[model samples]
Target: MTASSPTKQQDTNHFDPSAPPPFKVADIRAAIPDHCWIKNPYRSLSYVLRDILVILSLTFIAVVFKTSLWLWPVYWVAQGTMFWAVFVLGHDCGHGSFSDNPNLNSIMGHILHSSILVPFHGWRISHRTHHQNHGHVENDESWVPLSEKTYTALDAPTKLLRFKVPLPLFAYPLYLWKRSPGKSGSHFNPYSDMFAPNERRYIVTSTLCWTLMVANLIYLSTVIGPTLLFKLYIVPYLIFVMWLDFVTYLHHHGHEQKLPWYRGKEWSYLRGGLTTVDRDYGIFNNINHDIGTHVIHHLFPQIPHYRLVEATNAAKPVLGKYYREPKKSGPIPLHLIDNLVRSIKQDHYVSDAGDIVYYQTDYRMVGKKVE
Candidate 1:
C-alpha cells in the first residue's frame, strides 16, 4: 500500500507481534518470588532512605566536606548514580509501583520528581498514557512518532543541525524548559491535554509547592556559598536531563527493529511494541532502572522495575519472538547513528499498511542513475 492509502490490513509477517502481554494484572496476584514483592514496608522505606544517604554522602563530600581532595571523581560519579536511583523511586511512586498505597506514592512522587524539576502529576499522567500507547506512533504519549511528510518538510540545513550538532549541544537544556511551566507542551498540567484549562487545580498547587522548594534551596545557596548548590544540585540535575534525553531517544526513536501501525480504532497493544530492541548495555541496566525492559514495562507498567526482569523471563515464552530488550551496550556514537536513522524514516504511522520499512532517497547526483 502507498503512504496515503486507506487499507486497513498490514503485513503481519514483517513484524513480530504478540498477544497483549506481560499480563501484569494477572501476574500481580500470582505467588511473587521471595524478596520480589518487598512485603515489609520498612524494607521499602530503607531502600529509599539508603538511596538518599548515598546521595548525601557523595554530594556532601563533593560540595561541602571537600575533604578527600582526590575523591572528586568518586563524588561526582557516585552522586550521579544515586540520582538515577532516586529518579527510579520517583518513577515508581508515579506508577504506584513501589507501594500499595496511593497517598504514599503521591507524597514520595512530589519529593522526588519535583526536586528534580518535573511537575509530578503532569508527568505521571503523560507517562502513564505513554505506557498505554507505547508503540502507537500517534498515540504513544511521550515518544509519539512523526509522519514522513512531516519529516521531509524539514529543510536540509535544519536536518543537519538536528542530527549533527543540536542533539549533542542543546538537547538537555531544551528538555528543562520544555518540561517547565507554560511551554509548548502543557505547563505542568496533567489535565491540560485531556481536559479544560480550568481543570488544572492539582497542577497549580503542586507547581507552587515545587517553586517554593526551589526558592528555599536558592536561599540556602547564599549561606552555603552557592558553591554547594551549583556543585551538588545544579550539575547533577543537568546530568539527569542528559540521561533523560538519551533514555527516551534510544528506546523508541531510532531502532530499525520494528514498526507497526493500524487505522482508526483498530490499534492493538501487541503490534505497537514490535520495534523495541534489546540494547546490550551490560550492568548499566540497574542505573537506568531497567528501562531496558521497556517492552514489558509498556505491557504492564504496574510491574515494578525491580521485578521487570523476572517478568520478562517468565513471559518470553508467551511473548516468543515478539520480546525485545533495549540493546544496552551500544556506544554513544552508535546510539547517535541509530537515532538519526530512525528520525528521518517513517517516524510516524502511515494510513496504509506495509512492512516496518526505512528508506532514504538522495537526489544529489553522485553517480550515473539507474532508470
Candidate 2:
C-alpha cells in the first residue's frame, strides 16, 4: 500500500517505515531544485585541492613538531580525518557527481584514491552495487547483516572480530582484500565475480595504481625510517579506515528504531535507498564534505555533495516518515560512539525466510543466555 500524499502531515507514531512510500521517487526528485542537480566540475575540483592542501599542512606541522609526544596523537587524528575527506571527494567522482566529464572523473578518482592505496574502480563498482541493492539481504555489497543460519554457523573468533568494538572498526582493509563473510570476490582481483568482463580493464588499472602506492609507501618507510613513516602515514591510514567503517556501518545498521532489510520481491530501489539513515558528524560535517548526509546521497547520488542538505530539505515533504531525521550533534559527536557500541552488541542477524525483517540480537553475544 502507498503512503498518504505529500501534502498531508504524517502521524509519525503510526508511520511504518517499511511500508511503501506514498509518494513516488519522481515526486521527490521533482521537489529538488534544478540547481541542486548541477555538477560543477570547478567546485568539485576545489574540494579536492582543498583537502590535499590540508593533508600537506597537517603533515608539515607534524614534521616540525616531531619531538612533541602530545602533538603526535593530535596529528594522527587530524591527518586521518583529512584522508577520509579526500576519499569522499573520490567517492563523488565514482558517483559521477563530481563532474559531467567522464575522463576527468576517472583521472581525479585514480589520483585521490590511489594516494590512499584504494583500488578506485574496484571500490567504485562495488559501491555502485551497494547503492543499487542497499537493503537487500543477499545482494547488498557492504555491511549487509548475516542471516540467522549464517550467523549461527560463524566461528566464535569470526563473530568476535565482526561484531566486537575497535576490531570491527578496523575491518575495511580486510573487507577490500576479501569482501564481507559469504561474499567471494577481492576488490583488487580484476576477474572476480564482482565485476563484468568488460570492467576488468578498469579494475586492473586501479589495482595497479594501488600496488604502486603500496610500493611507494614501502620505499618511503625504508628511506625515512619505519617509525617516522608510521607516524606520518600508517597510523593515519588506519584511523581513516576506522572512520570509513564506523560511518558506513552506522548508516545502515544502527538506529533507535529497528530498520528493515528486504529480500526477494519486497526489495525495490526506492525502498532500499530509503533504508539508509543520515548522520550528524558535528564539526566534521563540512570537513568531510557532508558524507554523513547519507539518506539523500543514497536516494540521488548524482546530486553533488555540497547540495545534499538542500536536496534533503526539499524532498522531506515527499519523504514524510520514510525519512528519518538524524540526531543532532554537538561540537564533538561523542554521542554516536554510544550508538555504535550498542548496535554492535545488538544487531547481529536477520531471519532466513522473511521478505522483510529487522535485525535480531543474539542474546549470547550480549551476555545473556540464548532462549
Candidate 3:
C-alpha cells in the first residue's frame, strides 16, 4: 500500500469508488495465504538490535562527535523511529494482541513504553476502555468527546489548558495529565487522570514498569555521558513519536467516519469498531501489526496482532458502506488538520431516540455525532 495519495492526488485521481473499495478488509483476510503466519522473527529482533546499536552510537557521539551539531539530527532520526517501533509492539501487548502470553505482553509493553517515558499502565487502561466503550461519549477512554456547552462551561483556567501550548513538542508534556485519574495529576496536571477507578490497577503496573526502565537511562546517562543520552537515544525517540502520532491519530480522528453513538440494541460493537479507520502505511503496516486493520481490532481486542487482517477481511462484506480503509500517499498533515478542524469545536453529546449527536463546526444536524 503506497502511502495514500495527497489530497491533490486524490482530487485528481478521483478515488474511483468503483475500484472495489480498494480491497475489502474481508477479502484481505480470506486471502492471507497461510504463509503470512510463518511469524517472522526479524521484526522484534531487528528493532532490539537497533536499540543496542543506537545506544553504542550515542556513547560514541559523546566521546567523538562533539565538535558540531551534525550528528544530532541523525540521532533524532535513528532513536525516534526505532523506539517508536518498540512502542507499537507495546501497544500489541496491551490487548494480548502481540503474543498469547499475558505476562510477555506486560513485560514487553512496559519496557517499550517506559523507555519512551509513557506510563504503560495508564495508557493500557485508557486504551482498553477505549476498546470496550469506543465512540460512547461517557465511558470511552481518552477520546471521549466534549460538547460545546461542556467545553464552554469548563472554568477559564481549565479551558486555558486546551490552548496552553502551540507547538506539538511542547504540547506532548501536557498529555501526562490526560489520564482518567486526577489524584495522580497532583503534580498538577489537570488532564492527567482519564480513566475510572476500576482501571487504576493497570495504570499502576505500567507506571512501575517504566519506573524500573528509567534505571537504564540513569546508568546510560551517568556512564555513557549526557551527550549520548541526547544524541543517540533522544533523537530516535523523537523521530519514532513523529511516526507514532502520525499513524494512531490519523487512524481514528482524521478519518471521515463518525460514530453513530447508539445505545442498547442500536449500539453494536461491529458498528462502533467500523468507526475506526484503516490506513496505508506501505511497509510500516507490517511493523504495526497490521493495526491498520483497526476496525477489526476494536471489535476483537483479544485477536492476535498477526490475525487482524484476517478478521478485517472476514467482516468486510457485512460492513459494506461502513467499510472505510482509506489510503493516501500525500502529506498526513492535510488529512489530520481537516479532521481536527471537525473535532475540536465539539460542545456536547445529545441523545436522540436511539442515537447520539454532536454539535460543532458550523451548525450541525446529524454529523458524526461526537462521542
Candidate 2: where is the Cα deviation over 4 Å? 1-12, 369-371
Cα miss at 245, model 3 (Å)?
3.9
- Tens digit of per-residue lDDT, candidate 1, span 1-371: 22232212224344433233444334433533545445344545666888888777776667565766677656665566667667777888888777888888888888887777776776676677667666664566554444455545657654453444234333544433353111245645445563246647767766776787788788989888787677667767766665665566566653533344433344555556544544444556766667667666666666777787887776665665555544444443365445544443323323224333222223342133211
TM-score quality measure for candidate 2:
0.95
Cα RMSD to native, each candidate? 5.9, 3.7, 7.9
Q: After superposition, how far is residue 225 of candidate 3 from its true place, in Å?
A: 4.1
Tens digits of lDDT, candidate 2, 103-210: 999999999999988899999999999999999999998898899899999999999999899899999999999999888889999999999999999999999999
Q: Which candidate should be chosen as best, given lDDT against the real structure?
A: 2
Report the backbone clash tally of model 2.
1
- Per-residue error for 303 in candidate 3, Å, reads 2.9
**TM-score for all models, in order of appearance:** 0.74, 0.95, 0.68
